[model samples]
Target: MTNPRADRVRDVAKLAQRSARTRRGLFLAEGPQAVREALRLDARLADDGAPRLVAEVYASAACLERYPELDALARATGALRTATDDVLAAMADTVSPQGILAVCRQLDVTLAEVLSRGPRLVAVLCRVQDPGNAGTILRAADSAGADAVVFTEGSVDPYNPKTVRSTAGSLFHVPFVIGADPAELAQQLRGAGVGVLAADGYGPVDLDALQDESAARRLTVGPPVVGPLGDGTLGDRALGGGANGEAAPEGRSSGEGEAAPSYALEAPTAWLFGNEAQGLSDAELALADARVAVPLYGEAESLNVGTAATVCLYASARAQRRGQRTG
Candidate 1:
């Protein structure tokens, strides 16, 4: 533990690479926050008769003293190793590991496993290549109390060191499924009674209007108010208008003698967030039941994927929880 160049230090450092992590079925959780969360999850899983998540933990004496809880949790895993600052740095992915790091088993669950949970809200990342954006979205999903976050096949590796660091310990807090095929995943989610929505800037449905409609439903007593579209439902008004309240372009109007697709905001839902640059592809967008756009009131051209995702997920969270309370 004292030697910075020891084989054990090098082995843990190898987790910084995707190939090594894949081969060993482990990833590095750097910094005190990440390490602490990992240890806590390990303990929880152990209580369920599950295998330990933390294969090993390396910490400097100062770090253990600074965070006694971390020391206790790490020791509970029976994998804690006291190491010099130099050795701890050698084993970490960050420039500074915040005095501690843990080698945790890959925590991704199968798509079937996630679906079995009857999740009310889920976030799906499609071809998102940025580590920071992916991690931030996962963190946002966790904050919104999303049931799970799914990473499409082409999305960035959720286990990447930068991505793990960006989560700020949220990686341990949220359930995630990786390498899912967008089309198949969409089908499965819908089959599970979950509505799949794509977050597109040019989407026909305005997210704000959906929130308003949800709020209105919650405030109503007997029957819902009949909008001008005359379906006795707000779906047409909410879906047939653009973010600016303008009528949807030709062929996209839900008010034209057709049943407006009923996408109740309070329903079980999964949101698909696309890549930072190109956004959702046509095929990917097609997998969703509806495309939703987050409104931008200011001069800002667009919202970052993370910010947009936060808005969308929290929207669903609020609507779902409120619906539950009322029901």
Candidate 2:
């Protein structure tokens, strides 16, 4: 157990600041959800081994009694530590501490490694400054079954305590990279046969139009039509695996008058979203193969980054899983 004034406790408290976190190579997971996820994923933020993820846990006695699962995780990881309520409060970034907190290494990966998987769906956040919006987008990406999310340079740090909390534990579920170059990322994804679409308010391609085109194409070809090669030519390998003319999965059809199946969303796609206030810059959006505008029915203003991303990513998920039906 440690008192609020102890040196070690104070060191942990210092991580609340970005500068301290950068120097120490650690961040705080302030609540049960984030802590449990850190333990479950056991991702290695640094090259070191044996320490594992979730190096230490601090909880008040009342917290331990209330959330026995968290307590068990601490015990199982050999990371259990005791702190008085006041000590825990001093370490927390939130007003209402969840009574549990963990010291975790930052979670991130190289962009090359992220793209090596040949991801089917991805979201790229460009210059998005809000931590809450960033975290919510991550949660939406996870929900949409996106293979990964990329946080470009000038975007919020994924490990920011508020962002981590906003994810509600989804930060551990999906692979993400921070501080990546937007143009380079687009080049890499295109090289991997992934189509990059920029989500802009005045883009050329319409989301619903893409859906309609997808539904119509699915009727002719067996599966959703992934784009041709980077050179804008229809190579045999255009549709990813379906490029080899692999037959669509059994019992799938785009019947006439039926709702436009979300087949376009199925194609290997990555959506680039800009910041809330400024949106994507002209130069930044120019890197994409195409620009997609989310159709707004109501007269209300534009969609926020998080909501727009959720709609875009899930549209792809639904399109991709259209005939597969596995969930």
Candidate 3:
């Protein structure tokens, strides 16, 4: 019934590309748990029963021997493709193909979805190209209890195979959103009452200065947003942007509000982090209502983007939890 590219990596990639993987722009997850996540998203969740999964059913004996369980899981999950192992192998992406793979649809989310969620915190990533960094940032967003992870125009794709692997399981739990135009995201955040903040490698105010006291937050930055992109929204300040998009204050922003105010976590807030090496540009810095920086000790220069993002997100979470208990 199939072209039967069994035991072939190229064919596997191709078949998968043309099948659900392409229609939904998703990739194959090799591990059992990974497939389970896909099933969960599709409403095939079973807390204790044998988890249904997706896989090529008519595999060669060798392929079946390699991943016998995948067949059962596929049948359970209703993702079975009755094709020879050769065909299945043709459509996969692994070097030494794992007999099991689950198809996932890439999330096509927008900024407006983030606004409607009623979030209290958000994280924004800007031009963080490293897939590892992108994945770590997503994990941090979940750990920090962010409502959403937002990406800017030039950030790395969260669905990039390496990136998906890097996220571990956090990839499935987060509500991510992607936006092509920074200006459009800005308008959405404003309407949602999310105040955007920029992270500076050497800004005047401390990172702890971003705790807020109002509506839910929204964040934006990077290319494809990841994590909880629910009530909050996130975005990046144009790298090298100036105060009001001018100069001088480009490294940071000085405006009407108190430059370094810290509030409860329940206070709505969105925080933006910049590129890996170059940091946020002047124009980008100008876009934020305020600029935040990690309180450095030695002469280390600066923290890695992932490290900085984690710290900021965790801080917001901590404050928010504290507020919840107190309130």
Highest TM-score: give the candidate number.
1
- What is candidate 2's lDDT per residue for 1-327, written digit by digit as tens? 657888888888888889999888899998888888887766443334544777889988888898887777778777788888888988889998888899987767788887888898988999988999999999999999999999999999888899999999999889999898998898889898898887765553456666665455556645446763233121121111011111112122212222222224557988888877777786786787755566565543456778878888887787777735422
lDDT (C-alpha, whole model) for all candidates: 0.81, 0.74, 0.58
lDDT by residue (tens digit), candidate 1, 128-177: 99999999999999999999999999999999999999999999998999
Displacement of residue 89 (Cα, Å) in model 2 is: 0.6
User: By TM-score, how accurate is candidate 2?
Assistant: 0.84
Task: State the RMSD for candidate 3.
Answer: 9.1
The digit string of per-residue lDDT tens for model 3 on 1-327 reads 356533334433643343544554656554445554555555443554533333333334454455555445556655455545455455545555444455555664677777799767877777778888888989889777788888787888776666666676577777888644555665567567666666764454444333332222333222322122322122232122222111122344433233343333445677777777666776667666656555554444456678878877787677666655544
| TM-score on alpha carbons, each prediction | 0.89, 0.84, 0.68
Clashes of each: 0, 1, 58
**Candidate with the larger TM-score of 1 and 3:** 1
Q: Say which prediction, candidate 2 or candidate 3, comes out ahead on lDDT.
A: 2
Winner on lDDT between 1 and 2 is: 1
Runs of candidate 1 exceeding 4 Å displacement: 221-262
Candidate 2 C-alpha error for residue 263, in Å: 10
Model 3 is weakest, by summed lDDT over 10 consecutive residues, at 238-247
